[model samples]
Target: MGAFGVALILGLNALVGYDLLHQREETLARAREDSAAMALVLEQHATDSLSGVAKILAGVVEVLAVRADAWERGDADVFALLRRQATLSPLIRAILVVSADGKLIHDTQTLEPAGIDLSDRDYLMAHRDRLVPGGANAVFVGNPVRGRTSNTWFISMSRRLEAPDGRFAGVLVAVMEPMAFRSFYQTLPLSGDAVVTLYHADGPVIARFPDHDSHIGLSAHHLPLFTTLLKQARAGTELLDSAGDGPRRILSYRASAEMPLAVTVSSSRDAVLVPWWSKAMTLAVADLAGTLVLAAMTLALLCEAGRRERAMADLQDSERALRDSQQRLIQDIAARHRIEAELIAAKQVSDAANRAKTQFLANMSHELRTPLNAVIGFAEALESGIFGQMSAKQTEYVGDIRKSGQHLLSLINDILDTTKIESGKYVLHQEDLPVDDLIGECLRQMGPLAVEKGVTLTAALPGSLPILHADARAVRQILLNLLSNAVKFTPPGGRIVVEADRVARSLRLRVSDTGIGIPAIELDQVMEPFHQVDNSHTRRYAGTGLGLPLVKSLVELQDGRFVLSSVLGRGTTATVLFPPSRLRNRSEPLRALKRAQPAPV
Candidate 1:
């Protein structure tokens, strides 16, 4: 009986000890996962911010490449452009154009050239000295420094500007404030003693959440993160002691592949182990009570051997319950793993189906266009008497065929364009297009159809309009689609008007028509691809419903806005507003505008 009591005590101690260790490991694993997730979120935020700054610098470089003389001369238009670019994102503190000799030529903050010289700045020096390996165009990210103009700390993302002859002209710098990053970090839902930090590859901390002011601009080279972990991998998690006898922490980090930046999320070891410690204490107390009970049972057994059988049976029952509990835990874990696997598989299948659908639409559209074009060509030939003279009835039938073929072709083209845009394969060919010419071309193409439908078409233009920097074909398509829909829906003798004017900072183009307008509830649905306001089989209008949606997509792709408003049985108006960035300076010279003939009222 004494030997059995001793064995039972040893077994209970082993089981409790094992459970505590397992729980400790599980707590640490969860902490590692949480830190890693937070690190990824922070890393993406840093990447986006840096990428925006880089894009601004690249745009500045491109501008300088073409208008180097104007930029150097502090042209007002160039200054205004710089200011507009700066306002694009809150992350950008300023956009500066530095001369080859390091003189501050101009910045977005002022139109006049500043007397400040930035020759000593690392970003300018790096460009001037050709320190970047990508030659004149490589973007350089410099350490945080106090801005000469703003008198605040900012990090610089700069690119080397080049002359028309490919000579080094100067440096185009975009100033980014660290406070913007810190503000964003503060918004994250972080738990106790967890710190989120942004670091430059050069070892200096750029920003930190929970406000570590002293660490900013300070090198972290002494830490294993810089000395060992960063050298080993671009991303990883580790358990390490914090600096200067601070609490030990589990740190997860990720480095941006496109920029020399890293994000770290760290949680203190004690905070992560809090739940495990509580559980351990409770478990320890329970083990102590059980040990005391077992000791008393041993004493009772020595005096009364009959009680030993009962005690042994109770011990066996407890062991059986523990085994059953462990089996249930294993089964639950397995079920959870299976659920996760199924979810992943479902997502992959959905993505593949979407890709397949897009590809099918693209392929089928192209296939149909080839044969349909031949049919339209032959029909046009017959109508034009290229083959021979035909009877009047035959001529009318050929015209019908030609018209039907053209309509089908248009639908196919819309389908192809929609697929291309959805798949991100469409590229914009932007140029300086006169708004008047774009409107006139679209109006001329759409005029005949409107006239045949007995709908009067007219244009309302301001005295002068700014040149639109956009893809000419896309703008033309947008106008044509709007006008075509107007003509199709308008009753005979109804009027359709095209209007253009400068509204605030945007250029607005509106097409208003006295047509069978859509219901208020269906206006939003009409903007969806292939979604017709009248989708019933007996609908009066004949359309594939791609027109307005295509126009909206094209306008938005150029950073513009599209709005459609209508009232049932009254009228509908389609409005496209191009952003200021897409419009040339109003003061710049433009071609003479031609007034369109007025329609009969």
Candidate 2:
């Protein structure tokens, strides 16, 4: 009886505790919803206020652009017009017209002359330097600054005033007092620890509730909230530690669509849980009283001895189950460890095999080149009669030997270059070289091959081309490889063109061929070394398939970009874009090329 009573009481306690916990969750959820709603209201208010201020500034700019003489002479009519616009919104502190040189020409605040130079002010300078376009119906918001005369903190927004001819004339300024926002936020039912912040797109805190002068002009760009604003989420919620005050809070933020700013409303986490805590305490006390009553009723009337026996059996069964689970977990961990060890050993073996292959290729390159060079040298001597050849058959045989040796050497060189590029040991010699002359040289070298293949090769160059600060040899090689492939794959009656044109921030060289073009699905594979396009049209062409891949690597070494596009049976266009930093003017003097640092192996 006693054991049964104890179990019943314990179960009752657990049920009550769970119910209370569920209620606590529901209360907290409601509070969070309320906070989000209030934040939304605040966000809308801020957006409307700033948007109104921007519209007023736009109107002021229009007026200033038309009546420049009246404003320059400090006309009363202009001052009255500015005063009326400033008084329309309580958020605005002052409206002034400043000249191109940053001298205050007219003011709605006061007529007294105060020596103020705003040329160095960020907002004014931003307009002067053309950082923001003039007369775009857009406003430029500046960081918060303290007024010298009033000693009050203010954030300013301005619009550029342009002349009739679209030249910059001056700026129309509208200063907003942060205190006005603070005063409005004070009416909201927010806790003392709660914080409200407004961030300019450029990272400064433009306004804060429960306003602090020290925080207004500070940059909060490092905060997670600021970064979130940069991503331009319309309205979202997160829990973060406050940037100014270090309280963890549930912050709801919204970004302005019409202005370059964001607003965040944060509430303390502790305050949100206050109602839940109160309800939990009440439920806990009631549960304890009920448990005591129920336990007392069954204390003496329950079956104690039999209940104890069954409880002992259950405890034993639970222990056995726990032991089995632990054993299974241990076996699983051991199997995982073995698999990991095998994977590591396999990776090491694979790496070793790759190293061996590289070493063999390097050795074979030297071995083959040595004999090939000797064979070619001797054949050239016999063909030129330097070895005193007597018969016509000997002359023809010598010619064949020379051509065979040269072909073998070219194949070996291509393999070596591919190896070097793959091993990351490629180097470049960069210099100022005429782009036009480079194109001409490549054409001259490929002229005979083009004629033999019956392909029309031509250069489409602009009248004057910019010189490039690049590796002359690498540039020549890239052109040679591209031209060679074009002439090789193109049909006898096909056309190949080498074109150069200037693009924004880069110089582009395009080699287009009216040959059997590559299929769209196989474009990516064509840039892989030793992989050719798999199609009937490409089967007849003979190549080692390293030309395009080598060209890509060489262009990248010079800090350039390579782009390839092709449509089957239409054409293939290969473009090399060298960055503008590598472009030199036509008059640039020739200088020695700088050797590029060898790529890391």
Candidate 3:
């Protein structure tokens, strides 16, 4: 009986110890998974945000490619463009154009050049000295520096601006503040001592959640993450011991493939082990109680060998206590499983909400367009004197009604078109289209607008050009939107040129206008639906801000690439390149070609 009691005590301790170890491992594994998932989310956010900055820098360079001189001349329109671009992203503190000599040509915050010389800046010197690889379009990210204009900390992203002759023109730069990243990180669902951090590939901390301002811009190159881990892999997870007696941390990191950025998520090991600790404590208490009961029963059995009934009753009581401990242990495990199930269900709900929002947008756009069309038709009839206009004042009022209605209708149409394209409901009606006729008809349609604006509009087409196999109405709309935008933005004496030619087997249609050009930083953003270069409430231009986006969509629907470039205070060029696939071969039978048809909206 004594030996049996000793063995029971030993077996119970071993079993509970093993269970505790297993639970500890399970908790740590869960912590690592959560950290890794968060790291991936942070990495994607950093990549997308930085990629946007790169595109803005490239756009600025492209816009100034033709008229780099305007940047040097301190054009007010150029400054306005810069301001507009800066407003597009809260992360961007300023947009600047620096001449070849490193003098500030224009900055978004000031109407006139700041006259600051940034020749010594590493980012500027890198481009000037041709140290940056990847030609003119490559973006160079610089270490964090205090902004001279805003007196705030910011990192610079810059690209080299080259003239048409391929000479170094200037450096176009966008300054990004880290606060935006920190703000974004705060919105993430992190608990306890968990933290998210954004780091430059060079090892400086760009932003951190929980708002560690002093740590910003500090280098962590000596850390294992940079010295050994990152050197081995672009992404990974590891357990790190803290300095002194602090708890260890489990960190997971991911590096961006598109930019010089990395993100990390770290969770305190103590916090992760909390559930395991509770389970271990309960098990320890149960084991101690069972061991005491077993020892008492063993002693009673030995001392009361003569009293068999009494010894049997004591053993039954010990067995009942052991059964209760086992039941409690099972309940603990069941509770943990229930918590995990709840977490999974919560994630499912979040995903469903996102899908519902997208569907709502599509449905709302359709509902708005139906009544809007009717409003425009009634306004048009009233303007045409069908409602019996009596006086000059009444005529002007009717004209205003029609104009406002048209503008609202245009906005609704753009919204509907965007939704259709996004939902994959937009279809193209392909046909063999005459390049000359398409340009001519579009010009004719836009001639009145150009004349009203007192702007010169002309087309330069080669004597012979291949036919474009595309949706005729889509092509026509693309051309008209480009021309209309040119006319609307161009000054009274400005010139707008429409040129078409063949590059190998592809067709390139370019619309160049001597208008208030777009800021380089806004080039990519302007391609997105309803995004305008000038988005201020009191902006000089009027439209739905959908023309370029619509044109881009239509061009791409036919498998073409659309490129936009502009020079501040000089002009903008919208180029649509149709691939060899979309260019009709002269040898193909025109008789079997489908007639030009309009695509359903």
Per-model RMSD to reference: 10.1, 16.8, 13.4
Per-prediction TM-score to the true structure, in the order listed: 0.54, 0.48, 0.52
Model 2 segments beyond 4 Å from truth? 1-4, 133-135, 228-232, 300-601
Error of 1 at 231 (Å): 30
Per-residue accuracy of model 2 over 1-601 as CA lDDT, tens digit each: 6687788889989998888778867866675676667777877787899889988887777666677464443555576679889998998988878878888877888754356887888777888777875444567888888887788788888888777887777788898988787788777788766778777777788778766556788887888866664475777777677756667778887777767777777778777777777767765765665565555456424634455455545546655776897799899999999999999999999999997887677679879999999999999998898868559998998888998898778767777777777788767667787777778878888898899899999989899888798888889889988998889878889999999989754799999999888989888998898889877777877777888988898898887889999888888899999977788777777686432322211
The clash numbers for all candidates, in the given order, read 0, 3, 2
Model 3 lDDT tens row, 70-130: 5645574566567767777777988888878889888776656666788899888899888
Candidates' lDDT values, in order? 0.85, 0.79, 0.79
Best by lDDT: 1
Q: Give the candidate order by descending lDDT.
A: 1, 3, 2
Q: What's the best-to-worst order under TM-score? A: 1, 3, 2
Model 1, residue pairs in steric clash: none
What tens digits encode model 1's per-residue C-alpha lDDT throughout 548-579?
89999999999888999998888899999987
How much is the lDDT of residue 440 in candidate 3? Answer: 80
Candidate 1 lDDT (Cα, whole model)?
Answer: 0.85
> What lDDT does model 2 reach?
0.79
